[model samples]
Target: MQFDRDRFRFGIEAEYLLADKATFRPLWHNDVTFAELHNLMEAIPFDDLPSMDGLELEPPHRKLMPYVVEGYHVPNPDFSPIDILPKGVEIRTPVCSSIGECLECLKTLHDRLEAALSGSGYTLVSLSHHPTEHHFEGPQNKRRYDFWQWAMEVMTTCGPDINVSLPRELNDPIDVADLHRKVNYYSPALAALSLASPIYRGKLWKIRGTVGKSIRTYRRSVIAPAIELHPEENGRMEFKLFEATNRLEDYHAFFLLWLTLLLDEGLKGRSRDQSRIYDLGAVARFGLEAETVRERAGEVFAQAPVVLNRHGFDAGPLNIMKKRLETGRLPADDIIDYFDETGSLEDVLKTRTGLIHGTELAQDSSVNAAALSRSRQSMTGI
Candidate 1:
C-alpha cells in the first residue's frame, strides 16, 4: 500500500530522567542547565559524536543537534523510564513521517544511545510514570526555560498537570474541518483511555480520571474556550454534558445499550459470574462512554434505519433518540416517542450530515454540508 503521510507519520517525544554513569542514579551535578544545555549542545559540532553515559550522542541534523532538551529537578536513580520525574528529562527525536520510519528511528537511536551510554556505564529507559522519584528543575536553555516558564505560568493559573495520547489511526492528513471534528471528538475519549496517573504526591485523590482532570486543566489554561463547570444555580454538570456531546454522539446506540445491559447484569449480584460480567461490563462502558459525542453521532449512521423518509435518507428520529439515550438526558422510550413526533428522517439526516460535513464548524459558520462531506470523504477515503 502506498504510504499515507498523514496517517502513517509517527513520532515519539520522550522525556527520560538523566542518570549517573554508575549506579544508574539521577544526575544532579551538571553545570550546564537546560537552557545552557541546548545552547552548548547546539554549539557542539553536529558531526562530533560524544560518548556520554555510555551512549553516543549524534546530532539528528548536521546544521544543529538531535537532542531536544528538557530538564527536571528530581533525581531518578533507576534505569526504569517510569522513575524519571514529574517534569522530568525529555528526549525529542527526529520527526518521522511514517510508522515504519518511526520504528526504525527509535530502534536506531535506542541502539546507538545504549551503546554510547554503555561505554559510560549508564542506560536509558522508557515508561509513562514513576512513583518513587521526585524533585527536579526545568532546563536552563533560554528557549527551554521560556517554554517551561510559560507552561508553568499557564498551568498554575489553570488547575493541575494533564497528559494525553491519541491512537495512530487519526494521524492522517484530514480536511481541516474533519481534523477539528476528530480532534474534538477523540480528545475526551483519549483523555479517558489514557488516564493512568491516579496517585499523585503519595495520596489517593478522589478524581476517577487523573489524566482527564489534568487535561481539562490544561485546556482551560492553555487552550481557548476553557472548560468551566456549570454553576450550582445552573443545575448542570458542565463536564458531563461536554463529554456526552463530543464522544457519546459518535458511538453506536446498540453498542452502548449492550454495555449498559451488561453493567446492569453484573451489578445484580456478587457471584464470580457476576464479577466477571462486571469487569467486562465496566471496560465496555468506559470505552464507549469515553468516545466523543460527535464520533458517536458518526457511529449512529452505521446502524440500519428502522424508519426511512421520502428522500430515502435514514435520518429517522432514531438518531436523535440515540443521542438522548447515550447522553442519559432522556429515557430510551421517550426518545422513541420524540422520534415518532419528528418530521422526515431524511431531513434529520440532512441536518446531521450538514453538521459533520460543514467546514470549520467549530471556528467558521459559513461551511455547508456538501462541502464538509466531500472534504471528509476525500481525506478518509470513506
Candidate 2:
C-alpha cells in the first residue's frame, strides 16, 4: 500500500455567503433563486477553464456541474443543505492534475457564478461569517438545514460554516496515520493562515467586552468530526479553520505551501508530538504571527523548501510561499485594520474581499509569475 510517485490530482470546494451587495445582508435561496441558479450555470461560459464542460443538474434543482468529482463529493455549483437561514451555496471544482489548473478552474468557476448572480441583485461574498447581520433562515429542508441551524444557534449564539479541503492521500508529503496526525496537529497554523472572520454578528469579535483581546472561535473548530470528514480511496481533509475567500490566488498560495511539504524529506521523516496542538482561538485571532511550537508543525511548513530542494523536487512554489511567510502578513490583518478604520464591517468586506475579474486572472507566463502577480493584485487596493 506504500507504492508512490508524485502523480496525483487535486481540487477545491469553497462556499460563499449569498448576500445583497449594497446592503451586505445574507439572502434566502428559495425556488426562484434555485431556478435562476440552474439557468445561470447553463448560460454562463468559462473562457479559461479547460473543461468548458456542460453542466449536469441534480434533482431538487440544487446542484450543477459538468461532471462528478472522481466519483466523490458533489461537483461544483452544489446547492445542497437546502435548509438554514442566511443561505450559503458551494462551488466545487472537479479534481485537476496540477495546482495551476486547479486554481485556474476554481477562478473560472468563481467568475461564472459571479456573472450568473449579476442581475439577481445579490452578490456572493467570500467572508467566513456574515459581517453585519444575524441569520436564522434556510430552505425548506426540515432535518438537514433547519434542525442543524437551530442546534448550532443554541450553542454559540449563531454561526456560519465556510471552509476548504486538502487531500491527504493526494500523492505524497503526508499520508496514512501520520498524515492524519500531522493534519490534526497543524490545524492551528492552518487556521491562522486561513483567518478571514474578524467581525461576527455585528460586532468586532477579535476583542471581548472585558476579557481584553479575544477571538470568536466557533465550537466546531477543533477538527471535530461533526464539521465533516470523508476518507475515500482518494480522500480529502477538510479544514474548518478558514473563512471563505474568493481570491483564487489565496488558494493557489496555500496549495503551493502544501506542495512544498509534499516534496520535503522531513514530513514523513520524523515522528511528531501528538500533544502539540495549539489554541485555535489564538490562531484565528492572529494569523501568520500566531505562535505555534516550531518543533511541532512550524518547522515543517517553514523549512519544507530548504529540505525539499535538497531532495530534487521543484522548489519554485515553496519559494513563493516563503516570500509571503517573509512578509508575515495575512488577510485577517488587513481585514481587521480596515474594519477598525471604516468602523463598518460591511465596508471592510466591500473594500477587501474581491470578485475575480476573468481576463485579469489569465496573465500567465509561468505559474510563479501568475501567482506572484495575482498576489500583488489581490492586496493592492487594500
Candidate 3:
C-alpha cells in the first residue's frame, strides 16, 4: 500500500474547568449549562472527514458533538471504569488533514461556547487544576479506598489530548508501537513545556513558592496513562501529557512537534517506561529547571527542526517550546507570579485563555441558542 501523506489527520480534545466568572470558583450544579452547551455544539456542522477505503473508525466518537461533558471515574472491582460523575467539559476538534484546520475548528467551538456563556455568570477556563474546591464525590460509592483518590485527581485536573492518526496504508503494528515508545520516552520533557498547575489543595503550591512546575503532573505520575493508541486498525495516537493552555497556538506547536517526532526516522532516542515515569515526577517539581529534563528537552527541541523541515512542515510553531526551554520557564511561572502580585485567585482566573469577556462578549450579537438550533438542523445531513 502506498502511503499518501494527505491521509494523515490531526485532532485535539481539550478539557477545561467551568468557573464562576465573578468569584472564579468551580461552578457546581452545572448539568443544565453543559446540556445546553452540548446541544449548541451539536448544531455546528462537521464535514465528512476524509477516509481511506476498506477502513472504518472503530468507535466513530469524533462524529459526535464537538463539545462534550467530561466526568471523573473511580475504579470498582465489579464495574471498574464505569461509574463516572460529571466534573468538566471537553472541546474536541473534527479530524482534519492539516494542523491549521484543526486549530480553526477548535477556535470555532471555543467561540461558540464563549458566546453562550457571555451573560450566564459562568466562564470556561483553561488550566491544569482548579484553584479551589476539593472533596468532590458522587451521591453513591463514597467508600474510602485507594481508588477513590483517582476520582479526586480527575476532578481537580484538566488538560488536552493531542491526537495524530496515521494513514491506513501505514498502520503497521511494529511502526505504531515504535511511535508509541518514542512518545512515551519523551513525554516528560514535552510535558514540562506546558506546566500550568501551580495551585494544589486550594492554595498556591507551597504558599507562593515554586516547589514544582505542576502539582497535577506530580500527582499523576505512573498512575495515569500518559499516551494511548485507539481503534483496532489505523489507530489514532493520543498524547495526554499537555496541560490546558489558554492559547490555541500553543496547541498547534505541540501538535506539530508530535507530528515531527512521529515522522523523524533519524531520531533514535528512547527510554523505558519506568525511567519516563521518574522523569515526569522530577519535571512536576522543577519543570525545565531540572537539569536532566532541560537537557533532554533541549535535545528534542534541537532535533524537531530537522524532522519538521524534512517533512515539509513549517518550523515556526516550535518557537514557543524553544523559548520555554531557553528561559527555564513554564506557564506555571506566570500563574504563580500573577497570584503573588495580586493576591487574588479570581484575578488570575479572569485572565482569558480562549474565552471571550467584557465588552467584546456583549458585542457578539450573532450567536445564540435559537441561531445554533437553526444551524444544527441545516447541517444534519452532513
The best candidate by TM-score is 3
Task: Report lDDT (CA) for all predictions.
Answer: 0.29, 0.48, 0.67
**Estimated TM-score per prediction?**
0.36, 0.67, 0.79
How do the residues 68-142 of candidate 3 rate in per-residue lDDT, one tens digit apiece? 666654346553444345566777776666665555556666766765665666678887876775457653333
Local distance difference test, candidate 3? 0.67
lDDT of 3 at 222: 67
Per-residue lDDT tens digits for candidate 2, residues 236-279, read 44444444666655565455445444444455433333332345
How big is the positional error of residue 373 in model 3, measured in Å on the Cα after superposition?
26
The deviation in Å at residue 123 for candidate 2 is: 1.3
TM-score of predicted structure 2:
0.67
TM-score-based ranking? 3, 2, 1
Cα displacement (angstroms), candidate 3, residue 327, comes to 1.1
